[model samples]
Target chain A: MDIIKKLEWRYAVKKFNADKMLTEEKLEKLKQAFNLTATSYGLQPIKLLVVQNKELQKELVKFSYGQKQVAQASHVLVICIEKQIDQKFIHDYFARVQQIRNTSDEILDPFKGALVESFSKKEREEVRVWATNQAYLALGTLLTVCALEEVDACPMEGFQPTSYDELLGLDKLKLTSVLVLPVGYRSTDDMFATLKKVRRDLNESIIHIP
Target chain B: MDIIKKLEWRYAVKKFNADKMLTEEKLEKLKQAFNLTATSYGLQPIKLLVVQNKELQKELVKFSYGQKQVAQASHVLVICIEKQIDQKFIHDYFARVQQIRNTSDEILDPFKGALVESFSKKEREEVRVWATNQAYLALGTLLTVCALEEVDACPMEGFQPTSYDELLGLDKLKLTSVLVLPVGYRSTDDMFATLKKVRRDLNESIIHIP
Candidate 1:
């Protein structure tokens, strides 16, 4: 299908086929898509956790407010933000940019210096909020990719993040979960798959200044 | 090109071909894509301002930290959040849902009531923050769609919101700009277009639990 038709086919799957599993090939594409997502200042402060262990998935359903898709989907994707985005994070990002671009420090320093200075003035909460927004960006990218790839996914935010962090040991890894997506095949019995997608009319939601 | 290659070809464009413009057909697809984007609880408290007027675009460049893409692109898409999302907003969403899906209030009222209760307890800033995250989701969706459609776009956050709100009269419309995207063809003379996309290795960014 073309991109638009594929997008039309996409919805938040309510019932994932428990027997279905995403191939390693599909998993790899998702990882690449997540890595390729555009982030603020290209800082890339997010990490993705691909959980396929059934027992762990079952445990997470409770943290997800009893959403069984967490347990039934072939894989649970967790999008996370760095616990702290300090000067070191900024320095390291520039290092990656230089390594990839072969750019000189003279050109990179002014840009990096500005970012470092800007981040320094931000409180931790400010930085976290900023990073969380980037996490949402990643979520948006994955949802679209999943649709194009014909992967059924339910993008979720109703989960308890503190419970997830403690259960997944994300705190030790200096990460915090902000979004959860269950990916697999939609069950034939899932009625939501056939339901009409509700949306505001384009004219109602968009303003044109000509 | 396939979607992956298309994604690899994407970048935050710097300079746009000032004379080039997005055709109505392409703009319509983008509008549909924006409307089709999966918002939180389907309460799309987001408005897309499609600015195609050249003089207005040029005048707003200063507010965007002097970024010229704001002036040179075909359309400057201002993604804004509703200034307030109250119980009435929740009620209106369910009404739309009922209109589209013919779903009865017997099924929708509990969900609507929960949302109303949730928002009633939140401070205006909190609701604004929630709505702002949805805007980022829209940004991510648009970036991916633009890439797939081979449209050049620059997603930006450096613009002064207060300035944009005042200049664009967004506040009068009960909206606040959260993100800016300039969409058009990239300039042949622009150097940033050729820069290799920088990203961390998948191993460094993703964790897999089997």
Candidate 2:
């Protein structure tokens, strides 16, 4: 299907049919898409937690401000960032780069050293902001992927992160949830499914500079 | 092509073929894709500046930290956010919503009033951050669109936004550049094209909790 058609067919699905579940194959595709999302400096500080347990999803709905889509959807994908983005994290990325690309250390050392030094000097909040930005990129990628796969999804940020971290045990993993996406099949009676998408006109949303 | 395959085929092109250009039809698809990107509250707070002028792109190269790809691509897409996201912006969105959906004012007024009140209380910086996050979503959507269209793209944050704003005279439009993307065909000499993508294994990036 054409991408534009796929995009037009997608929306922030308000209601999901709990009886319809995503196949394992489809969920695997989403995992690959999220991993491939581009991040600044390719540090990839984001991690995705795929929650398929209905009880946990029910528990999460409270933190999500009573958005029942969290519990009704086939799965809730939580995009999280490492609690600390330190020198060791940067080193690990470059080491993986070396192992994968077989690039010489001479070619990698300068950029690696520079990034490690630069990141080490940044404030914790600044790092968190940077990591959160990457999570948004992943969210964006997964949203598109879900649309193409005919998976209904709602990208949400209205949740209380501290509560989610506590319930999901993210703190122990040194991670903090930044974004949540619930994906499944949309309910047939979802009123939002039939509403025309409200978007700005092209001229209002785009500028051409020749 | 499968979405996963298309994603695997995509990489940040280091060198764009200056002689190759995206067809007008393809560019139109990108504009539509950007407009259709999901944003928080569906406010559609982002704008895309499509630059095809070689001279302007050449000028942008310096500000882009000497990244020549900014100058060589068929077009440079600058994603910007409204300088001020005020109550009026919220009202305008609802006005459009009313025009398109013909939903009763009774259904819209309460949500509109709440949004206006909530946004009125936010700091200017807070609103800017929220709007910028939407721009990242558009960026992510466009990245997927570009990949599916067989267009080579480099999603860049290396540029100096203030310089871009001044050069493009964006402040006059009440817009601030938040992200930049260079899109076209990749040059064969771009060695990065052939290297394996460096990504974490699925187990490292995704945690499945059943």
Candidate 3:
């Protein structure tokens, strides 16, 4: 498939065809895409919340700055971060590494110890920024996957996170929503779907240091 | 190609085959992908530096915490953010939007004005965080592209950016290095290539709200 052509076809859909829904197969690909996104040190500290119920999606509209796409899309995806990246978190990651790679802790301890110590010293806000960056990374990956699969998506960062967290019950789950993506199909009348995408010239965007 | 298989096949290479180089066509695709990456407000406040000079790559190794991949990969990509995202930056973006989409300022002024006003009141640190997040998003899009194209890449965040800016002469360009990715072929001797991928269980990673 011509990737650039597909990339060109995607836009931040301003309006979605509420009646059109993504197929189960299409939704599954997106879930797998997020799960496989590369995170810092492979310490995957992300959770994807898929909200499909119409009422819930409608409720999210206000939190999402009144974006109707939230209620219209086949599914609204909330990308969240772990509340804490403490020592226990590091230990669990190492355990998974050992289980998957069968590497002895003797070989992992130095790195693990360093990570634990590093995280211990980091300010809570610092860790949040770090984790939030990973969430943005996941959004990038999911957006690419959607474009390739011809699924419509509008990624929103203008929403109120506090309201979303409270409404979605993310506080109790230890997941603070950092990014939102509503995916499905674009309404035929959505003028944005047909507009030329605006990007700085690639020549200006990239510098080659030879 | 099965995208999932491609994603599964990719791992962050710890060592790269120094002799192997990416073809010009392959590198161009990457450049295009970054240019097309979805950014917040489509502001495009990021620049990618492609470092291909062997001597320069070797020089970056020290700043990158002695990571050999920096020197060994065919090219080291430095992802950077614009230091000042002020009103002038916002106006230039709208100018591009108008030029490309043939949309009149009459229709764009309110939104553009709000962005200008919004940015005017934001603290410098707040602007930096927003732009840096865009850079992270670019990194994610580039990583996914690398995986699909079978290019081995190692994304590094544990580097000294001040040194990078000095060595790369980025201060003059108003760019602040935020992330790095070394991309090329993985060395056969790199045992990490064969290790099983470690990710949280999909069932646990995804929460469905119906």
Candidate 4:
């Protein structure tokens, strides 16, 4: 299906039947789609955690404000960002860039130097926020993929991130959950399924010049 | 095309043919797509400015470090975020929510109070950063739409925001340019067109549990 049709078919699914599940191949496709998301400076600071265990989902549901969708959905994709971006992280990215692209310092020297210097000058909080921004880019890409694949999803930020990090042992990796998305087939009983989408008028939301 | 295919076909077009331009229908579709982008609390604190005039684009090109794409692309979309999020903005959002959702104060009163209190407790800089975060959401939505429609886009942040806001008279609106995207057809001769997409492996980027 085309994008418009996929978009029209999608909604913030409110409920999911636990019995239904997504195939491994489809889930892998979602991951690939997310990995390909573009970010500022091509620095992908986001990591996705795909959770499908029933016990963990049930535990996460409480942290997510008792949202049933979290527990019942086939999988919950947690989008996380590195807690800090230091000189080592920046150098490591450039090192990978050189290895992957087969380019030497003669070709990548100035850009890498400028990037590292700029990152070093930024406050730790600023670096975290920048990484979080890239996470949202990944979120958008994944959402589009889910829609295209006809998977039901609800993008969420209402969860307790601090507790989530601890519960998932993500703090050890210096990662923090920035967003959660529950994906599955939508239940027929969801009232929100029947409601029309509400959005601002196009003219009011956009300014155009021709 | 499926989203993955569309993404595969897309690239950050570094050069755009100056003479080529987007049609009115295509532009309208893009505007509609952006307006419908979802946001937290359904509060869209971002606005889009679509500029096509060559002279104005030339002025913006300087503000964007003389990036030729800014001036050559058929349109440059300036995503601006509210500089401040005060009680008034929160109240306005809840008011609209009530009107559109037909929600009574009995149901929304606590939410309204909580939202206002949340915004109030946030530091002034935090408010700007939060609003800037919302702008990135809109940027992601627009980029996805561009890819879906086969429109070449370059998501850019390499620009002077303060000067762009001043030149665009955005301060009066309490808005500041957070991100800029140049959208148009790509130049066939661009060197980046044929390069394979570079991304980390799924095993490295995503962790799966089943």
Best-first order by DockQ: 3, 2, 1, 4
Candidate 3: residue pairs that collide: none
Residue B181's lDDT in candidate 4: 92
Candidate 1 regions with alpha-carbon error over 4 angstroms: none
* Alpha-carbon local distance difference test for all models: 0.92, 0.93, 0.92, 0.82
Q: Model 2: per-residue lDDT, tens digit, A9-32? A: 999989999999999999999999
RMSD of 3: 0.8
Model 3: what TM-score?
A: 0.99
TM-score of each: 0.98, 0.99, 0.99, 0.93
Give the Å error, residue A72, model 2: 0.4
lDDT of 2 by residue, B1-210 (tens): 888888989999999899999999999999999999999999988899999999999999999999999999999999999997888889999999999999999999999999999898999988888888888888889998898899999999888999999999999999999999999999999999999999998899998878
- DockQ of candidate 2 (2 decimals): 0.87
Per-candidate clashes, comma-separated: 0, 0, 0, 0
Which window of ten consecutive residues has the lowest lDDT sum in model 4 chain B? B33-42
| Between candidates 2 and 4, the lDDT winner | 2
Best prediction by lDDT? 2
Q: In DockQ terms, which candidate is top?
A: 3
Off by over 4 Å in 3: none
Give the per-residue lDDT of model 3 (tens digit) for A87-166.
Answer: 89999999999998899978999999999998899999999999999999999889988888999899999899999899
Which residue pairs in model 2 clash with each other?
none
